[model samples]
Target: MTVALMWEARASDGRGEELLAWARAQEFPREPLRRETLRAPGDRVLVITWWDAPYDAELPELPEPDGELLTRAVHRWRFESVGDG
Candidate 1:
């Protein structure tokens, strides 16, 4: 089975670059099979990591950034791969 974890956050004011740098600097206990970091308008950053584990298996995830770094709590989600589509 394959599991994908999604973590999204919105940075405060004009701190998008800072938030992106912070997210990229984070070190996981173990690296994921695949990892992607993305940013969008409104100073939002998103990270998705793919793993070779079951949907319910324990996995590494990005921790919430410090309160002053974000406008609100981070959002996360987990999904089991269905198909290439």
Candidate 2:
């Protein structure tokens, strides 16, 4: 199993395109987008995503946003198979 940690604050300007591009460059067993859940907090929101592999595993870049800048801090984890677990 793989685990990922993402933490960040949005930038003053949006980063839509940049983020999209970054997502497009990722390499994984399946779709890079994976899944995401967001929570709105007035003018800002929180994003959570799951990945097939850890962050240091090496992946593609993400797209940039055209709106307010978003800051993010991310971490990833990779776990052994169920049998191993």
Q: Which stretches of model 2 miss by more than 4 angstroms?
A: 5-33, 67-85
Stretches of candidate 1 above 4 Å error? none
State the lDDT of candidate 1 residue by residue for 1-85, as single tens digits: 8899999999999999999999999989998999999999999999999999989999989999876999999999999999986
Candidate 1, residue 28: the lDDT equals 93
Kindly list the per-residue Cα lDDT of model 2 for residues 5-67, writing each as its tens digit: 343334333554454444434454555445453433422333444556654666433333444
RMSD versus native structure for model 1: 0.8
Model 2 scores a TM of 0.39
Worst lDDT run of 10 residues, candidate 2, spans 73-82
What's the TM-score of each model vs. the native?
0.96, 0.39
